[model samples]
Every structure is written in structure tokens, then in C-alpha cells.
Target: MKKILVCGMSQNLGGVECFLMNYYRNINRNKVQFDFLCNSESCAFEEEIKHLGGKVYHVCARSKNIYQFYKDVNEFFSNHAKDYDGIWVNKCMLNNIEFIKYAKRYNIPKRIIHAHNSNNMENTIKGKLQGLLHYIHRRSIHKYATDFWACSRDAGSWAFPKEIMKGENFRIIHNAIDSEKFRYNVDTRELYRKRLGLTNSFVVGHVGRFQYQKNHEFLIDIFKSIYHKNSNAVLLLIGVGELEDKIKEKVHSLSLDNAVKFLGVRNDVAQLMQAMDVFVFPSLFEGLGIALIEAQVAGLPSFTSTNVVPQEAKITNLLHYINLNESAIAWADTIVDSQAIHRELYVQASMDYNIKSAASKLELHFSNICNK
Candidate 1:
């Protein structure tokens, strides 16, 4: 079996984590096995990874202590780098390239740096510095990583050099999922709606961490406008982050504590999508909005920001793009009008995102690398 060490999985079940879990569950283990390496003690799908015969390792985060970070990574790679054929570094930013550096130092044949975000979401000084650090490390990535990959083209452009993005070593790996799991079903809608006590309400949903990237503050504002127009309209937020408490404060300050439900870190996201009348994703930027694609798969009418999200995300016509500069009331007006669930043509979903096909290609790629 071709064993590959997958890195950059954090504690949260965010887009990058989900992308890993989706493919991990489907890939043929006999042909290729994956062992995860995270900066934290454990990752979101720890139990599943262990159950599937995959191992999970932890290292200190570079942001917390640079010395310990280097020491831990060095010790780990020094002792265990030979256990795998390659190291796949899945990252949202290029703030740290030590994993690729160490992989190359250890002579791991295939070193991949996979990008998962288009840009930094924070507007603060720290965010700017992080962006600059990301820019500074792109050359290091180009020098050390044998393969360059991204969730989308936009993400590749953000984290890699132009030559790498256009070269043979680079590939755009679509964030494929089990689309059938998210396919709309009226029965599922009724089940979850009754369960959540939204039987007679218009449910507006969003699934993302309450971070600067996801823009939970603006989401709440738009929901406030939605509540004014129709009190029965409710917002379902699924995911929590450091900004969650602040967002809760904003929601309470707006007198919307009862109308918005904070459903954090759900395993049944597919069913949750069915209970929604609409999905709103106002992210400041994205490598690829996997949740938006899931919303589309659930056949939920979605509103998104086109300024940063790639056009490849327009898999279905149910997705609507809105400008960030527009007022919350304008967002509310558009969401309320366009989300009447008037999907005309059921387009065939037999496309590249099917998990089976992606797994096959990934396994083949890994197998080819090992054979060479």
C-alpha cells in the first residue's frame, strides 16, 4: 500500500477537514492508506481515522511557539519520515512551510502543498502580517514541494507562484463529496423541521465557523432584516469559533436571541440542510465553498458573494451572488424573493465531484508516485 502522511488537519471540522474526511472514507485502503499529522492533539475525525486503520499524529503549532514547533516537527520527521512514501501538506495559508521543508530534508519523494483558501479573512494587523508571511513563504513552497495542489484555481493563485500553478506538477483537486447524502428529500425536510420546531417557519441556514472569514456578524445583520420583514423567518447557524461569543452578543444586542439557533459542530449536516428553506454564505473569501456546494446538493436556494468565490462553485442555478457593499436589507430582500424554491430543471449531477471517481484518481496518483 502507498502510505501518505496528510498534514494541516486542525481540531475543527472546517472545509479542509471535511475534504479530507470525505475522501478518506471512500478511498480504497488496500491500494492507498492515509495517516494524518495535525498541529493539535486530535482532529475532528479522529475516531473514524483510527477505525479505518489510519494513524493521527500531533505537533505544536508554529504560531504558539516557534522553537517548540521546529523541534517537534524535526524530531517527528527525523524518526518517522521514512514510514510514508509522501507528505501531503493541506493548508489554508502559507504561513508555515516547515512541513514541506522537513519532508524534502528527509527525502520524502512526493511533497505536496495543497492550498485551501483564496486569501486571509482578517482585516486586523495580525491578519495583514499573516498575509505577508504567507506571501514570503510561497518561494519556499516552490522550492521544497514536488507537487502543488488546490481546492480551486483561485486558491492556487493565492498560495503558489504562477509557474507552479501552470506546470505539470500542479492540479486542481475538486472538493468532491457524496452528493447523494445531501440530495434533497421532502421527508428529511419534514423530519428535521418538526424536530427543530420549524414546522411553520421559513428557515434560513448557514454552515461555517463564526470566524472573520465566514462573516457571522454580517449574517446576523441580514437575519435581523429578515426578521423585521417576517418574524417567522429564523436563522440556523451551524459551527462555532472564537468569534462565536461575540456573534452571540451581537445577536442578543439586536434582540434576536430567540430567532437565531446556534447549532454548533453537527455530524448530520446533510439532514440539517434539508430543514432549510434557504442558505446564505457571505464569506469574505474562499478557496472553494464546500458548504455552499452541499447547500446546492440539498437543493437549498443559496446566496453567496461572487467577489472571492470561484465561478466553478456555480454547479447549479440555485446559487445567487450578491455584492458585499450592499445593505443587509438588500441582502434580505434578495434572499426573501429569490429563495422561493423555484428550481425548474433538475440538472444531472453526474460530474467530476462524484467521490468514487475522485478517490480512484487520487489512489492512482499515489500509486504512480510510489511506483516511480
Candidate 2:
């Protein structure tokens, strides 16, 4: 068996975490046993991973300067590097330079950095500076990494500009979801909506952390516009983050307490997806919108921003690309139209973006890498 070490920083149940967990569960574990290394003692996916028959090693990485953490991580890698054939780094986002460097120092044959977002690379001077540093570090460590996988083409391009264009050791592998778990069933939808007292309402749901990237302020604006036109329309914001209070305050200020509901950190996301009439994901940016694809698998119509990758926009007519400056009224108008649509075309679109298919692509890549 090829022993693989899956290392990650955060324990929060976000898009990147979800993707890693799915990969752990669905990979050909008999041929490749995975050992997870994480910073958190109680990650949201911990129990699920154990249930999947994988081993977990808690690193509990912490440091006052973050530079010290690298020294500690390097020591850990030195002691443990021989046990694993390859290392899969998840969310190698902002603060994983040291880990990458240490992997290189230890001479790991296969090091993969899987990026999950486009992440505002050109947003500010500081962002640009960091991007330059990241680009430099990535290139310096290029010899150590046998391959690079990105959740979307945009994400891949943004994170590995030179590597991708040069056709050197890069692939765009999107995040996956279990279609069996998020299957389309009308009865489940009706039952969930009725249980939630939303049987009479046209439900517009979005499942994601209340982070700046999600642009909750703009989400509230759009929800307010829709509520103003139709009081019976309900907005479901499922998932919690720093912006939760801000969003709640905005809803209260708009006197929309009844129309908008905050369901934080739900365990039944798949069932909830079925209960919705439409899914609104107007995220400013995403590596790949897993929730949007989940909505697709649930046979629910979705609307997203132009910033989201077109590949993820499974239902072309349902999706609208609007500038950030676009009014909430414009988003509302589009949502209203999306809710009115009755199309089978979207169901076909959903199948085309199945998570199993995405996993198959990854499996092929793994086979190719081992062969080479």
C-alpha cells in the first residue's frame, strides 16, 4: 500500500475541509492508506474520518511568530517523513510555506499542493506582494512537488501561473460531493420544507460561512430586495462565521426577522438543499462552489456571480454574472426569475458535474503519477 500523509492547517468545516474529507473517504484506501495530520484536536471532520477507517495524528501546531511553527513542523517531518511515500497538502493557502519547505528538505518523492480558491490575488498592494512571495516560494519548491491540483482552472492559474502554462505537473481537480447523499427526491423536499414551516414559502437558500469572501452584506441586500417584493419568500442562511452578527444586524435593521432565517452550522445540508426552491451563491470568488454543485445535485436552480468559474455554473440560464457594483435589486430580479423556472435541462447539467466523476479524475491522476 502507498502510505499517504494528508496535512492541513484548519479544523473548521469549510469548503477546503469538506473537499479533503471527501477525498479521504472515497480514495482507493486498500491500495493507498491515508494518515491525516491536522492542527486541531477536535476537527469537525475528525469523527467522520475515523469512521472512514483512516488514522489521525494531531499535531496541535502553534507558535507566537509562526516562523517557530516551521521549526517544529520541520522536526516533525524529519521524524515521520520515512513512514509515508507521498504528502498531500490541503489548503496550502496563506501560511504553509514552512511545511512545503520542510517537505522539500526531507526529499519526499511526491508533494502535492491543492489550492481551493482564486482568493483575490490582485486585490491590494499587500495581496500582490504576498502573491509574488508565494509565487517565488512555489517555484523554488517546484522540484519537490511532483504535481499540483486545483479545485478550479481559475484557482490553478492564480496559484500556479508559470507551472500551468508551461504544462509542467499541474491539473485542475474540482472538489467532489456524494451524489448518493444529496440525491433528488421530491418527497424529501416536501417533508423538509413542511417540517421547517416553509411549505408555503419559496425558499432561497445559501450554505456557507459568513465570511467576507461570501459577501454576506451583498447577500443581505439581495435578500432584502426579494423580501420587499414577496413577503412569503424565505431566505435561509445556513453556516456561521465572523459575519454572522453583521448579517443578523442587517436583517434586523431592515425589519426582515421573519423573512430571513439564520440556521448556523447545519448537519443536514443535503436534506436542506432539497427543501429549497432555489440556491443563491453570489460569492465574490471561489475555488469551486461545492454548495452550488450540491444544489445542482439536489435538482435545485442556482444563481452565482461572474467571479465564480463558469465550469461550476452547471445551469447556464439559472446563473447570472453581475458586477460587484450591481444593485441588490438586480440580483433579486434574477432570483425571482430563477424561482419561476421549471426546467429538466438543469437536472442533466447536475449529473455532468457529479462528485464521483471528479473523484475518478483524481484516481486517474494518481495512477498516472505512480506509473511515471
- Candidate RMSDs in Å, in order, are 1.6, 2.8
Question: How far off is residue 43 in model 2, in Å?
Answer: 2.1
What total of clashing residue pairs does each candidate reach? 0, 0
Clashing pairs in 2: none
Cα lDDT tens digits for candidate 1, 1-372 = 889999978998888899999899999999889999888866888999999999998888888888988999999999989999999999899977888899999988889889999998677899899889898998667789888889999999999989898899899888988877887778888999999999999899999988899988899999999999999999999998889999999999999988999999999999998898899999999999999888887787899996878887888888899999999999999999965566432233446677888888888888876677
The estimated TM-scores of all candidates read: 0.96, 0.89
lDDT of 2 by residue, 144-212 (tens): 566787777777766675745467687767666787787777788889999999999989899988876
List ranges where model 1 is wrong by over 4 Å. 343-350
User: Which whole-number lDDT from 0 to 100 does residue 189 have in model 2?
Assistant: 82
TM-score of candidate 2 versus the correct structure, residues matched by position: 0.89
